[model samples]
Target: MSISTVAKKLPTTAIAATVIVLGIGAVAPVAQATVLTFDDIAPISYFNEIPNGYGGFNWNNFNYINGSSPKVRRTGEDNGRVSGDYVAFNGFGNPALVSDSVFDFNSAYLSATWNNGLSVTVEGLKNGATLYSKTVIVDTTQPTLVNFDYFGVDELKFTSFGGVEPNYLGGTGTQFALDNFTFNEKATSIPEPTLLPALFAVGTLSIGSVLRRKQLNQS
Candidate 1:
């Protein structure tokens, strides 16, 4: 073909190639969600604490009461047994006390940004007896994502207390906590469209170079 004809075709070819690459990238698919499982429990004491007179344990002073009924008194052995301190929940109290305490699992303050959904399940056995067992659904739509803090207390009134025995206080055998928390997200359905711009830029440069060389030859 003549030089003029070649120059005319160069730009079209470059633009076509750029468009094709952009199309390919835009049609690419995204990724899938992930599941999380916990074998060991992590403490969130920053948000949770045991209150005095609520249970035999006082998280404020890190002490445990070691007496029966109204005679309950603080003991050194009761310290640091429970994970999170009080105030982790909107209203911190022993769930076993009057079956009124609702532990907030979002206290971990873990960020779940861009997550499609979050599922949390808490299971604990105190004193060889089941203290709390429940799964909480968390909404992750907010731009400012925050996780709940989990807390537990030793109540003298609950069967989970293991016969009001102080020896079983903080041992893993008697007190247990777990969080089966999972984060999920929708897979990227397509590759980013950014590639289109890049491809176009490269193609434009290629065509410009070809035209410059053609002009030089004609001169």
Candidate 2:
């Protein structure tokens, strides 16, 4: 109801109701960010298998897994990295990583060994169509953290640039890696069980004021 209408009715009750509703909002639970460290996934380095049911099995939580040749370099490994190990794309005449299972990934950090045309693209797909896409060129010798923090998508596609050959030790393809690869976790619109203690205290005070005002009007 409008302010004038509420004021025309029982002012104390309406104001108290508003206060209680706002108190609930102030005490709502918040969503947290989920980071994919790719650290404890063992010493395995190759994400270079076909998707599940074809010749692979979800790549251990990473699904829709299809690409030229992708590999994961674990932390503490002797792989050339800024610090820890990371995942890289091997140029098997083609260097691309595609997936639709990483939902709600806002931004990612990539590490490259200065390979030419090192590009990464992320997109949102719906019903086998491209909803949106963002591409980045990674030409660096260190671990670079790139942000697509503006849009949230259902599908995430990471592709290393082409025209380069695979030489994991010193050449072109598999020398690229993604380290500290992370994403955020978000909560649904569902509300929690109850409000915090402070919100309850304020709500009680608001109700008390309404009762006091009612008594004064009755007198």
Candidate 3:
């Protein structure tokens, strides 16, 4: 009945935490996310015509996070493909161009180009569930790549998909031309969390001083 009554009978909606430092056991360590391809922005680098935040990734709806759609960088228009430009979303409200860090997602590789076909899933959230998913479809005119698979998460999402069809590459144009999208990050390096209580209190005082010097050398 201890351990806080087995953690109050557990089950608090997916709680899988662990940290037994003295014996060494921790998690959260994977790495990849940071592969967007608006083709590095430079088409003019704007504050005037929109489309800004590049590598670090950003773009929140209504016009870029709480402003009310007067406009603010959604990386739209320009239209090309994986290597040329790519970055446009406006499939109406299901917008997602985020990734300023926080990722443990497992597999991805993309190049969307959809329009009336409306297709694209790609999610990997945490704290909000939905570990990973993948859907595809691209009307086909350009922009391809597209791949999916996920597990464990930090948060990665992309929406719009009218029932999976274009498995990897093809296109239409209701406006959803993303590109080069790739994810992997979960590489948590280790040794931090405030140094795990002084490294588990110096490994529980060096195993209780080697079990009291082996019971005082067996008396």
Candidate 4:
């Protein structure tokens, strides 16, 4: 083939090769899923403070009280208490009370961001005829293998005016201690094998173009 014909084909072949490599990288296999259990919460380094009791004490504090609200009072004074109908301790450090029996948990939130396939399950008490639960999908990068995936919940409102006192709660005035918690990451799906066909097509087109250019130069 003429020098000009060969030169033109060179750039096109290089471009095609680059495209194939990039496309394959984009469809690479996903990494393994990570599992974070209640024991993981013990480090205390991974969590952030969230408001839990009256007087603005928060969940990390030892003890406090809430008169008008269904407060999340720590079971024992000085952080001794550890279990109760309305506690949420993840086997880490101190627990906090969720003051105001009929209050709403609209402000509570997770400190860290999670990946697309990560799953977080919070196991807590639903006392005072008022249940509590929250699950959120945190936004993070692909390959959910990173540690400390955090999320938040809101609108945990409660009602106990009827004095029903759900079993989850120790009863009005009775403090509840947080016991356990767990977090886990669901596996990410791998890329499909069908994509191979498209890759092959791209490679074939590149080689065909190079041959066609050579033939034209000879003609």
Candidate 5:
């Protein structure tokens, strides 16, 4: 109510404002995970070509097949599906790519279509440049869950190379299947550089308020 009381309260309020600004600056950006199981694609008797814009990513040389489809040979597709009845594979044993503007590749369940111990090379790329790559061996007998944990990539290229070929459904030994593909649609964020100026301004105001209070006490 008095002039001295109001002056004391002014410093406390300014310090609180400075703390609030610092608290906001300390917050980190959160990245949410997105799982693309390929189960959303309608099943055909044989295979379904995954189109662009499916799960917000462009799919190249990828096809989905129903695990129990009559056209699917049981020997080739055995244990290929991780969830639901559908699974995605590189059509014709070609190198495949799943791309977006930017994303974080988390993990995926992979299996060879016809070959056991198939060598699959997965590369993370940004702006047409390779950021990182990992090679993992998979088998048709069971699905191998590979954790990539790659962040801030715009493209993921999968190349299947040498493996043991079995003459069953006439599949190339290089062919591989993908299921339960998980990723983050966005990259993790860093605190904005613009926040620094705001924090500095608030700190200065807090210091000025404290100095004013000291001067009043001295008087």
Candidate 6:
């Protein structure tokens, strides 16, 4: 094609490239799921604090219970363990938190420690903004399987409320058990769809201009 003809078509070519880039940007990446069983955390005495970086997250007010401990019957620590002898619980009957990069909260098993019909509120957050929140009730004898399916969250905060206090248990509070916590990791900071087209337009136009100049020089 003539140089002038190519020059006239350069913008059109760039626009076409921009369309392709925008299409790719519009497509989100497939996420891979991860399950945190909390069984990997070993227990010290009857329970141990879930340290920072457990299952790629920062944990607060969480501890792993040793079901085999002598206090299991009195404390009801073994009632909720699904995968192993250990299950996580909120320490001091306070709110608990697990945080990391963006991820989807899929599901988990929940149970009450010293009470029945315990109310638990779980909130998903990103950048200090709440994205998802749900309250669930669990039993002391059996665990409730809760499917959250919350997406694109960086933090999961849990708070417990009123429940029937059991006089049999040595300790009593709003504590709940957590096991088999599942989630899907999300790619962070993807290019905005609106910005993709402009970036691709500049790149495509620069490459086209270079090719056009080379052809003119050869002629």
TM-score of each: 0.25, 0.56, 0.27, 0.26, 0.80, 0.71
For TM-score, candidate 3 versus 6, the one ahead is 6
Instruction: Flag clash pairs in model 5.
Output: none
RMSD of each: 16.6, 8.1, 14.0, 15.6, 6.2, 6.3
Candidate 4 C-alpha lDDT tens digits along 49-74: 34453222133432222211224322
Q: Give the per-residue lDDT of model 1 (tens digit) for 105-158.
A: 222222111112223333443344556554443322221122422234222121
Best by lDDT: 6
lDDT of each: 0.31, 0.45, 0.47, 0.31, 0.80, 0.82
How many angstroms is residue 105 displaced in model 3 relative to the true structure, after the best TM-score fit? 4.7
The residue pairs in collision within model 2 are 34-185, 45-72, 87-177, 88-176
Clashes of 2: 4
Which parts of model 2 have CA positions greater than 4 angstroms off? Answer: 1-14, 21-28, 44-83, 88-102, 150-152, 163-170, 191-219
Ranking by lDDT: 6, 5, 3, 2, 1, 4
lDDT tens per residue, model 5, 168-214: 55655578888899998785566544544544565567778779999
Q: After superposition, how far is residue 32 of candidate 3 from its true place, in Å?
A: 8.5
The order of the candidates by TM-score, greatest first, is: 5, 6, 2, 3, 4, 1
lDDT accuracy of residue 46 in candidate 1: 27
What candidate 1 gets wrong by more than 4 Å, as runs, is: 1-193
Q: After superposition, how far is residue 197 of candidate 5 from its true place, in Å?
A: 5.5
Q: What is the overall TM-score of model 6 with all chains considered together?
A: 0.71
lDDT of 3 at 82: 42
Q: What's the C-alpha lDDT at position 115 in model 2?
A: 56
2 versus 3: better lDDT goes to: 3
Over the stretch 62-135, how does candidate 2's per-residue lDDT look in tens digits?
A: 32111112332221112324334434333442444434433455556664433545665655554456767777
| Runs of candidate 6 exceeding 4 Å displacement | 1-29, 74-76, 188-219
Q: Pick the candidate with the highest TM-score.
A: 5
Task: List candidate 4 stretches off by more than 4 Å.
Answer: 1-22, 27-86, 89-176, 179-195
